[model samples]
Target: MTLSEELLMAYDRQLRTDAETPSAIGIERLGPLRLVTFAGGRGFVTYQDLAGASARTISHWVAEALAFYRSDPAIARVEWKTRGHDHAPGLHGALLDNGFEPDETESIMIGPAHSLNVQVQLPPGVSLRRVSAERDIRAMSAMQDEVFGVDASDGNADAILRRVAREDGMELWVAEHEGAIVSAGRLEPVPDTDFAGIWGGATRAEWRGQGIYRALTAARARAALALGKTLIHSDSTEYSRPILERYGLRRVSTTTPYRWRR
Candidate 1:
């Protein structure tokens, strides 16, 4: 199958209609999809089998789902993660009609585990390793928030702590050069799936294209494969998109998140 076809099938089988695993907290059923409510009063929608839904069905689902989120006072913001190949008939129109403004459309990059798992030559005075220390985790999360342009969040740190507390098979990796963190990423080995997710990859502004991000990704990929994951996936921005492309990760689809704010 082509990348687009695989994308559609994946979303159908995994995201929209029959997502086997929901987010760790605050998920409610909205028809066939799960409406995810997370710590920051943020709502998310995901499903796996939306490829076959008719235009009218898609229309109704979108309207009803927005209404459900809109009625909830605690939901200060919401994102409907729409995949590029998903047969979400009239979804764009419906979302625009409902005041959900589109955010950046990111590349849905996916590929074999080995392709991105190559060794990286870290600069002298640089080190890479898995981190579990509470202080290190907080600092790393704070750096991520800064890079992503969000305020430093205790909730984010708390969640990392919770993950560490549970020993949830989630690994945080960071690269340090000259006694400071230069790049970092997370490896999430999804339980019972051949896939692992590479998320929250961030690099300091001065360290942008010196193979640090790729090295961080390679480290995560190596770890994932060691744990028997065959596939890797990420929602990539333009910066990292080119790097992943060079590593044989195809842009299987696009995910444009539409956010609704109170």
Candidate 2:
């Protein structure tokens, strides 16, 4: 197998379970699925594979998993993360039949952390730093929500605060211009593994085309390397995929999130 293929295999083997939900408040098992509950009334579903189940059996598992999440009144939203390389026959039909709407597909990019650690010139009057203060985090979250075209909500910021309190090796980084946050992303170093994920990367519309986001990614990559993480991974949208690709992160596969709202 090629190096990218080998790395993708390692990623599937090492980072597919609770490692994907390090901040989950609760987890339950249903066949090969891991039903996870996080802080903010969010439910998530993921697994390494289907264990060679038939299409009919997989459909049943889907219905059962949806029922499991639906039973919880606290769950406002559930996302089933499906990988492109998995043998999930009838999975798409099953999800749509059960009211789960598929979101945009993202590239699963992975590569050496050091490759992303190159220097990037920030725009004039812009600076990057690690944020921890509640006020700072809230600002960063709000900016990200706006950049992503989502309604401003405190739920994400609150959940992030809880994770911060746990000290789980998750780092929040941001780029600021004259005291206003223009870009932000997170670095989560997975425990007992060589991988750290770069997630929630967002930059304001006006900030696009500049190197601010790339610089922010590099800062996070450097931080991950400092924490002994050799591999960097991300489920990157079209906006960020090319940037990561430019940094030598190979797109090993695709991941699409199917969502159900309560």
> Each prediction's Cα lDDT score?
0.81, 0.94
Off by over 4 Å in 1: 2-22, 54-56
Every model's TM-score: 0.89, 0.99
lDDT of 2 by residue, 110-214 (tens): 999999999988889999999999999999999988988889999878998999999988999999999999999999999999899999999999989999989
Per-residue error for 58 in candidate 2, Å, reads 0.9
Best by TM-score: 2
Q: Lowest-scoring 10 consecutive residues by lDDT in candidate 2?
A: 13-22
Q: What is the Å distance of residue 75 in model 2 from its true position?
A: 1.0
Model 2 stretches with alpha carbons more than 4 Å out: none
Clash number for every model?
9, 0
